[model samples]
Target: MGQFLQSFIFVLIVIILGCSKHATAAQFKGYEVKSSSTAEFNESVVRFIESQKEFLILFSKHSAFYRFPKKQSIDIQIRDFLEARSKTAVKVRVKYNPMTAEIQKIEDLKN
Candidate 1:
């Protein structure tokens, strides 16, 4: 009886742990964006689609590609940054509005 009880508890624990992991993966299945737009896109792994002057298209493993309108200030900064890392395909942090997908800021990926 005691052995059976122990085995039951162990199985219960394993089941609980398994369920939690599945939940986490599902919850964060897509994008898994972090806070702030600058924080959201950058939190994953940012890559550009075209890096056009008029707009920016970026996505990561955990996110969907979304177009964002760019301002002159951000355009120059992003263009220059992408130029440098374009070949290298470096990971970067990005922040934007999840609701509008509008970019707010772009920064170098923190080491």
Candidate 2:
């Protein structure tokens, strides 16, 4: 009886931990880009935008990539482009995780 109880408790703990982990992962914030415009698309911005578009189309079709976590924040994207240009002389630092089809993060040191 004691052995059975221990096994049951172990199973319950595993179930609880699994559920909490899944719930936390599900709660991660995501952003969707609404529009891409020429006004914001300079040379560096253009490259970054193209890469992002390709990532979205070829990789993360369902998930939306955001410049920021906020509802309407494109500043982070723009800043990332500018920073990449300054350091690498080209738009870089854009990362795509093919497995997840998600842009893990975007950042710019320029601002």
Candidate 3:
């Protein structure tokens, strides 16, 4: 009986962990770039910090990558792009605010 209860609890824990999404909702209380031209760049990410969410990529197997991980909010589109590209490393062009250094847009670049 003890062993069976333990197994059931373990399964429940696994299920809960597996179904969980982001531990917390992304909240950033800063200005938005609704009408800015913003700067664009193609760069790679050498590291990822889960505490902050945002991106623009180019990361070939090169050692020279961009410095990053600012605590900013990312839109749904950017989040989706990152999730889709999670399986493979690819290059991307990012439109970002130079003043705030917040990524506003991101798109995959053609090789």
Candidate 2 wrong stretches, greater than 4 Å: 30-111
TM-score, every prediction? 0.44, 0.30, 0.39
Q: Write the per-residue lDDT of candidate 3 for residues 1-111, one digit (tens) a residue.
A: 999999999999988865443321112222334636577677543343333443433344534333233343544434444554554555566556666655564455652
Question: Best TM-score goes to which candidate?
Answer: 1
Worst 10 residues of 3 by lDDT: 21-30
Across 1-111, the per-residue lDDT of candidate 2 in tens digits comes to 999999999999999987865544333333333332211211222322334333221112223432332223444443333333444433223343444434444333232
lDDT of each: 0.53, 0.38, 0.48
Residue pairs in candidate 3 whose N, alpha carbon or C atoms collide under 3 angstroms: 57-92
* Candidate ranking (lDDT, best to worst): 1, 3, 2
Top lDDT prediction, candidate number: 1
For candidate 1, lDDT tens digit of each residue in 30-80? 122344434355543355655443455555565555554555644444455
**Which ten-residue region of model 2 has the weakest summed lDDT?**
38-47
How much is 84 displaced in model 1, in angstroms? 2.1
TM-score of 1: 0.44
